[model samples]
Target: MNRSVVKRVVIGKPLKTRELGDQKINKLKALAILSSDALSSVAYGTEQILIVLAGIGFLAYWYSIPIAVGILVLLTALILSYRQIIYAYPKGGGAYIVSKKNLGENAGLIAGGSLLVDYILTVAVSISAGTDAITSAFPGLHGYNVPIACLLVLFITILNLRGITESASVLAYPVYLFVLALIILLGKGLWDVLNGQVPESLHTPIGTAVPGISLFLLLKAFSSGCSALTGVEAISNAVPSFKEPSAKNAVRTLTMMGIILAVLFSGITFLAFWYGISPKAEETVVSQIASTVFGRNFFYYFIQVTTALILVLAANTGFAAFPLLAVNLATDKYMPRIFTIRGDRLGYSNGIVTLGAASILLIILFEGHTEMLIPLYAVGVFIPFTLSQSGMIRKWAKEKPSGWQLKLSVNLVGALITFTVLIILFTTKFPQVWPVFVFLPIIVIIFHKINAHYNDVANQLRIEGAYRREKLKGNIVILPVAGITKVVENSLAYAETVGDTVIAVYVAFDRESEKKMEEKWNAYRPDIRLVTLHSQYRSLIRPLRRFIDVIEEKGEEHRNSVTVIVPQFITKKSWHNILHNQSSLLLKAHLLYRRNVIVTTVPYHLKK
Candidate 1:
């Protein structure tokens, strides 16, 4: 099938430009679509903390609740700070915009690069964690986790390419289901704890601590639990995707997402502690808790299914934010301009596909193990958190708007706290996360190079003073033909109209073909000059390029502009293209860079 037909089938028919406004969603649907990442982290975020603390002993797992509380405090700070961002910069560039305007270009690039890396990792990590849930429930499917994660990435990529509203509608139900499922699980678990019916911890007992809970271990656990805050900034980054009064609607959505996430994360961590759940090789803490509360029945299975779905859909948050972030960089010339172009469905299709591909690569590289991937996760995100909060402080200081002191204080505390967290996360996650620091600078350097190249092109292309025109003394058109055929005849006919001098040049590997071509050209009598060149090496491109070079050198004296028309036959079937030599294509590629030479392709379609 053709591209248009396939696209229509995949993403549905293309919507008109005017229909873009109709695609805007309300705060209700926005909560699910944009907040899935932060909300779903409750699945693994609590587990991550327990994983770290469990290293010391079973008693160290008690630290999970306190660390979760700390993460919630940070979440509250971030929500308030980003709400200010939504109102202040409604166009939604997120940290990149805030840093660029308030900090500097270099800081902005740093923030953008950090966020880009984090967003890509979000897809890989979320999908991997989701697949973990799957394997936890069905041990028979344990070995296929990487493949499962990759397929989930591809599915979400296609859904987002369908456009924002379409993806929101399809993904929103699962988020609600996940929330409802967890609420039911949490209620039952809490009731058991309160009524003195709490069962003993099901986890295998770890012996007494080798080294008791040190401040280092607590910081490590806290940093891991901070994954719960990954998607908090997504709503602020996507303010434009909401309905009228976009910023207000976006802030409302942010508030709702924050409250729901706080409740779910804290509840999950508390239940896991009470049940003495620990990360297992084959099961997640959430899965263990759910199985304990709901048993091996429908409710238990329901929670697992929704948990997997939400974790996979958490990549949707990255999908929503990464494209917009990329567009901001592209607009600033730090990225390729193609990322700025919206696809037929009005989504940043290039950015979406790029994220999906990167995520798949990461999943394959890490073998879809969430524990291995988690260490590399929080640093990229925290870098942005620190920079964005710092940038907001500067904004408040400079503008000094009404209630600027309160805004500045809010941002100031956020900056100091996030900066401290960033340091702790880095120190705790060193060596495993050292690669992120190395790559962060490389990404920033690449952005600088891209921007510099675009600026140089703009300078060269700028028509500053006046338009310059020079009258051409002569016009010469070179038509490369392989043999005497209808395709060549049609090309020669058009070539005659474009220039006063048209030369039909043929490259012949042997004398027989040359002699035959001369006779046929003489008989056809198209009234254009015929030049036949022999190549003993059987190289079509080399012979044709030499001929064009000679023509350009000779034409220089007469101020003549030269054009090369390559005649290529288009077969009915695309597969038939492989049967042909594609010599015309090669000739065009070779001649396109010659000064004062124009290359064109004239295609003659085949009927059968």
Candidate 2:
């Protein structure tokens, strides 16, 4: 049976199944899903500040509060802008949809590339940050950061594969508990500060300032704090994850997430400042604040546990966003088409696995160090931020009514602000974060180019009525045989089936092998016509290619009808395939250049 024919029969019509049930996610549930990644960032979002400030000495902790405030301002602006997105394009293309519809393919590609890189980094940073917290609890795991991070990535990937509703349901409690724990801790810290009974630092000399306070240090601290806003854009990508009235529900969810994040960020930053948190004096600002409030009591343990749990869940955001983005890109032909296909569970399995592998690699490369990866991180996030806002502005400009000038003016202002921030982010961070910023876009551009090339080739090969008119006037088939093997037998059989004049061509790379092969051919069959081409160059495809050209130039009648039947051995096990060669594939490609000739493969499968 022909494989293509069998495929057609097996896939006769699309099967209808209720795999994705009509479960409508309300605003709260949608918020849970969208905020899973961003909320989780509270676990180690300030890890960069602690690490960087520590390097600059303990006094830098004071600046962390102000920087966190700046980041909060940016986050608030982004949330407001994205509210418009949830209202406008609720189908969940996120930044990609916004840019593509309004700014063109290049802008869309830039947005897509940036978002993709950011998501991958989010996974790596989150998992590693979680590992850091875990290691703090159990110093025994200190040396296994990469292994633990990779395992966590795989674990998150599995949870995501269980389906969106399932993941959201399972994560809701932990995320809620995390929020509650932070609120309690922050409240306790403030009460202590107001009472003037602030817990003393473990190290009395910790508050001393370092010597330098350069612009570079400030930018570094800003970038570090910027990580808290990492997952704010997730809501934009998760528009479809909501139930009916997707846009309205998405906007509601977005609003909820914005409020929650704002409140949490403000509380956390305030507590850290009130307690005189120092990155140099502690590994994490949260940990430092925890120690100050709880004084190594049960409350401290509770904070550690919840913080770790939340950071681990931060990777969940990547787990969710990766698949949706993959589906969108695959639909646009930017990725393998298989990524676009949902599994029985209504999950993008291929996309999940791809994301998992990428995250693991990043985790290993940065050794799960979120601080080191933070500078490299925001470049991807803000590129999409700027372009998507610009896209939204363009949309409003073109679609808004004359009477709606006020609303359009707000969008224009948002776009300008976002664009300016994007410039500052890139200019400020790209030099230090050059590796990720420079490399990620290049990778996406390469993918775009490759996809474009495939599209162009596919267009050229698309058959029409005129294609048959250009077919060879006379029938000729070239069958390349190696030995008295099943592959050779299958090739001869298929050649006979073509109902045309056929030639069995063989190339002799060496005198000894050629002599042995010729003798064997004669001994096996004396009646068949065998044409041997000898090459001292030890090249197989080139000699066979030249022979076909010789046959073509003999006459137009000969050139008009040539069909090459190349026998390829197919093995079920990929490793077994390595034992064979790829000369047949090369020959088939070379034959395609000849005018009026068709190339077909006769595959001989090995028996198990």
Tens-digit lDDT track of model 1 for 1-608? 99869888997776655576887889988999999998988888898788888788776776676688788888899999999989999999988899999999999999899889888988998888788777766889998998888889989999999999999999999999999999999999999888978855543333435456699988988988887788788888788889999999999999999899989999998888878787896777888999989899999989989999998899999999999999899999898876876776878888999999999998888788656656667777778788989999998899899999999999898998899888997798886788886888899998987787656544433333322222233379999887766677667667766777888898885688889999977776546689999875456787788898889888887888888998876766675454345667777777777768988888877654
Where's the lowest-lDDT run of ten residues in candidate 2? 464-473
Q: Evaluate all candidate structures by whole-model CA lDDT and list the values in order.
A: 0.83, 0.72
Off by over 4 Å in 1: 199-211, 468-608
Query: Taking the candidates one at a time, how many backbone clashes does each contain?
Result: 0, 2
Report the lDDT tens digits of candidate 2 across residue range 383-471. Answer: 77778888877887788755456556555666665566556566666666778646766867866764664465344333333111112
Model 2's TM-score against the true structure: 0.70
Best by lDDT: 1
